[model samples]
Target: MNRFILLFALCFHPFALIAQQPVPVKPRILISTDIGGTDPDDNQSMAHLLMYNDKFNIEGLVSSPSYGSGTKGEILRMIDLYEQDLPKLKAHRNGFLSPAYLRSVTKQGRRGNAPYRGYSKATEGSDWIIKCAKKKSDQPLWVLGWGGLEDIAQALHDAPEIQSKLRVYWIGGPNKKWGANSYAYIAENFPGLWFIEVNSSYYGFFSNNNILDSVKTTDYYDKYIQGAGYLGKDFKSYYNGEVKMGDTPSLLYMMDGNPENPARESWGGSFEHLSRSPHVVFNSATRITDTVAFCTVVEFNLKGPEIVIPQDSVCFWMETPYKNAVQKWPGYYLGKGRYGLKYVPKQAEIVSYRFRSSIPNVDFGEGKLTVTNHWPGKVNNTDYKLGANWYSDKADPALYEGKIQGGKTLSKWRQSVLTDWAARWGWLKK
Candidate 1:
């Protein structure tokens, strides 16, 4: 072969010495998921993780559905399927964890979002988090916040000592809406913890990219997953077999390359470091024309019916729109004509809200706020670097869909990730 051709072939060869990465020690992981929730994406992501279980030190699989009907039963259902398919999985890879062991670590987290105080009573899942975080290990516990951050917040509140041992990768976009209080609790109290809050970056996994059409989300499952195995066959019902594993990026980030480095390029997208999350305040009722940052706390202070209560006892609620559904945030006491109410918009959608008071005297208030991807209102923050290891997506967009987003960094590697995943389908039946 010609010199240039030989060099190209050697570099691209699947089994070439340079192409092989040194086997990395499995990193410990604890996944909090809303598997049977409104969106079936968690189910898809969980299936993906189980297929690649041999890659990580899977510690916890807690059912923590922030919204919808996700339960431990749903998670256990997935495990049952994994058990049925285990024989095939082991034939392909030796280190696959036993289904019984996976089930043993699974626990039920809080049913819904945390209360106004950021944490409710501790659940089995929250306690398990404390247990796993406290375990003696050289590796830091990688807590993948797939759904609500309630259990993690509860765990941190229950044991602040575990903060030093945890590394969080939260999927916060719309899920953030489900657990604003818990998210706020963690952000305000545990600011020093090493955290990666990937709000929109996870969209890259299923969103449109420059990858081959066949390998894209719509086609990959049919081509590689349909006849694969028990888990693969069951995957069809979730989102009709199309790939929408938004929460899988947390697994991808640790799947290859250095899991310790967030800025480094890997199958999962690289991230930007940020010192503080955006926190904005409103003095009066916000108008539909008003705008706020995505995932940032937007504190509201309004002068309503002046009937005062004992330390703002009257409960104030707000109903906001989210992806064809109306979601209400309960118990924000801005009704004493005070600034006690604060809300965090999940996505970049225009947030229209109607405030309803539980007390008869305190009345209703309605308004709207346009949300954007920018960190602070009216301008993008260039100084996103942080002293602590906090990571997020860049405001810049090298690849644009509707606006500037950091998803391109992750989407750029979609082809390789999907190709590898497609190849693994063979293991399911073999």
Candidate 2:
């Protein structure tokens, strides 16, 4: 009787397991990074991404540039990197920035859109963005933009079908001026879409110099160089010359807009009612079509429809805790702060990102993921290999130590410390 029952249970067990299986996995992201738009913050952001790629399935990388005359210059800079070993490490090619962009950047002056050099075609950011957003999975594809929103705005304008499948985290603009550049484009292209903005003035302080006083310039030099002592060598070689990285924290904020840190606020106005968000129609008032959301920043003093906060005061959600926000923007933050003003929207995802370090990872089929703990996922290895030949054990000790200990000159100590850390973590061979 026992053997018969066991055989019967075994036969049905397979059927039960099949019925209760998890859903199929979906392709995750296509990250757009503006490699050399303005500052070194972008570089730090890139490093952070590399460190955490194991957590997120970074589908592709599309390099974008700023608006106006600087656009091609930025694209050219990316092309230069693309022509090298940089893009391969991230497993992607240049997206959106085209050959015409390269010509303008390089000043080669070939008129008309020529085929992008060294490749059959340059993948457009707009196209990739639209495709990713329309994915059938329940999980929405995240679009992180560190540069201007031209490509994404264009994509949305072209593909309205993707609206519900994607969310945009744009790190641009100052407070009280959200959608100031392309309000019409945004309103028309992405109505009811999730938009998070990371403002500038507030992020500049922590991301550039004071990471809650934990990460400093010294640590950067040390961690980046891998102990070969390239302070006076390669790094210092460009110090006063001309080398910068873009701001990562700024990008981060944009990707996960906390209601507390809004790019657009009603500076110095009281909440009589939420103000009417304007919709500019075809650069004319008569062509207007939509009247979208214009929410309130409660506890903020408003004066005649304007919102205001102290220049130094931090804005965060009061009701929805910051911890809750972080959970939404997983695998994309450096760290969290204890003190700051908070904000909450009763009906929004309200996510925040921590640097890639926070999430545990496993391999997904196409890429790795650091998913919510409640879900099922996979991980992948994202370790970086730094060459030790760049260092010589015999460098000027005083200069190296000075740089490491926060003194006047660059040295090898910084490289040593970072290399040691990387080695310890199996990112590089010791």
Candidate 3:
């Protein structure tokens, strides 16, 4: 009986020990972007991703439609640049034969991808997207898309297996008043990922204010438009004088995430007239006379700040102090003005919450939005270095040319030049 009792106790002891073991914790992340084609803003975003390698075990970067070439091309080009341009130290550099390295450089599993030989100088964004999503299940992957929604859609389509593992935080799409693009069917097809769009006309939506208008083109032209320049002198000269039309915002969105000092980051939302709500002429652009009503107000608990398009809003900002503030309120026809108040029945107070100690009001244009208090404020400090602007914050394009001769490799030089331009253009933080 004693021996039998001892055997039973031993058998259950291991089971109890197993139950007491703690589960492993996964990493958290927040991705900033200026995706699309190989533009300065996108380049800045890539630099932000690379600099903060440790804070975010960055699963992958989703290419948005802001730059130029759309999602696939943007991802491929950025990845290629990282592979070709980023300076590799003696311990870090991978030769021609290695497989791609996806995870943070500090991790033990970090190595060259042996199987994908075609990834020579390729970014492998597609591979990064699928693999990062598959790595963990519990921790939410935060993807901030301040540009077009191309890469996220492609990632979802490419890797159905990891769809449930990630969440998307974007900043575009039509406002509540206007119906969004029907053809750009990314979120609709991939329901597994959480889709959050931050509308600009909405009160809390972030804005990429026309900082370009604030500076003169001739002030910084010809600085880096010479030989080996990304966009040569012809492009610069064309853009320098009034004769040039200027690059599209889409192109700017793709290459870099910002174009000015890292500290000059922007946020969403328009609250210029909140102080005088009812009396103010809040515009309502709802057009419905019968069964189908597209101008109805939708409300959700905003974990962060959200721009409001109240139902009761009248088209009041026609002129005066609120002229710039209320120029284009969403949900209204161009020539037509507001007729009445659009309201949400159960709507309560307007609430805005910020992470305890963030960059305050770092804006990334219309499509980008930040969650409130999602992580402790300390996370920002720990990951702050990753967000530092690698290029000079001066608003001069010539800085790009001057830096190339400063001991930079081909990749570093390219990155630095792009980053410098991005910082000047208000796509990156200082």
Candidate 4:
């Protein structure tokens, strides 16, 4: 009886079962980017991905330019830099794929946006995606759409059988607008398709204001990336020599999370499920407001030794608010060492107030004021006309409502990305 009890416990014990299983590693990733485009941020993102090549099984790198001027040549240029730095990266960790192998897989997709229906015609990139998906593998191929989803839509349209084997994570705020037809086709036909549409949350990577002081400064880039290796050298050249890998979050999400479930929190920001196809619901809202009023108070505190101030000499100066071509009100003294200003802001105005006092012995301190009638969700059509700035008409409410696991903030997610970056550079251990 004792022997029977021991055998049963051994069979069902949770700890025993857990101990027998192998720890899962990162997922297989196929990056589809529009590098070499008008926005150079994609190049920075590619450099970031190559630095951490050991973390993922990178299957393909395809250039799918939707709007900007970019192609496979730019992808090769970035990879050439990666080839030069591969030796140094390999010294820190194993499993770095050969540069030649990466080059062999890099291909060009549709040069511009897809037709109104999404799939235009077969391209090397789309065909490659189909081939990769159909290959026998225990893991699913994660098609990361950093640029647009034209190639992905083409793959699905050509080989619908691979739908079950593929998982898509599209960076779809403005990119969605570029590939509207393809996105619409995929959504209309594949209701149950396994996909995650990341719109505003991806903005968290670059928009995180709470990163470490070191990361915010030039010292971090100089130490870890700039002049560290060939890859680092190429990375510093992009974004006016700043670390702005905006699209790196797509891979960061797959690096350490449950690949089967995107809803779980990971280094990549978490997402919520969509109730309907986002394409069908997206429409443009008209501009409802012409002017927005802003007010702020500035104080000058004379802390140190006092100095004489010439009467009527300009004591303070504030620049006109941005997009204030037709200023309704300009900066003026409110008396008692305080100042206030009001102005009409241009459409989709991201405005800030700046002021300086001429008081010789006083330190100009900051003050606060409340703003009213500031339209929060006003659509700026001018922004759309410039580039990919299409906002969904009926925006996905889940985007605002969803929360990452552990209630993680963008700052925390950025830290995770920085940590991995540091680890790859041999600054920190794996």
C-alpha lDDT values of all predictions: 0.78, 0.33, 0.29, 0.60
TM of each candidate vs. truth: 0.89, 0.40, 0.32, 0.66
lDDT rank order: 1, 4, 2, 3
lDDT for 107 in candidate 3 is 16
Worst 10 residues of 1 by lDDT: 14-23
Candidate 1 segments exceeding 4 Å error: 1-23, 211-214, 302-314, 322-325, 334-339, 376-387, 399-404
lDDT of 2: 0.33
Model 4 C-alpha lDDT per residue in residues 203-302, reported as the tens digit of each score: 5566534433235423446666655667666666776566666687787777755766555555666655555431111011112232222111111222
TM-score, predicted candidate 4 vs. hidden true structure: 0.66
Pick by TM-score: 3 or 4, better one:
4
* Model 3 regions lying over 4 Å from their true place: 1-40, 51-54, 62-68, 71-131, 150-164, 173-195, 201-430
Root-mean-square deviation of Cα positions for candidate 1 versus the true structure, in angstroms: 3.9
User: In model 3, what is the error at residue 34, expressed in angstroms?
Assistant: 8.0
Candidate that beats the other on TM-score, 1 or 2, i.e. the better one: 1
User: For candidate 3, lDDT tens digit of each residue in 1-430?
Assistant: 5998667655643221121112133234434344443334444344334422433344444433322344444444445544433333112333321115432311111112111111112234445555666774667665555453334444555566665576544443222121121112342344334443332221111111213222223333333323322222223433232211111221222223321212221121111111100111112221122111111122111122232444322222111112244222212112222222112111122222111112222121221112221111112111112111122112222222232111111112222233344343231111
Model 2 C-alpha lDDT per residue in residues 246-327, reported as the tens digit of each score: 2333222222223222322211000111112222111111111212111111111211111243332222211213543432
Q: Report how far residue 316 has shifted in candidate 2, in Å.
A: 40
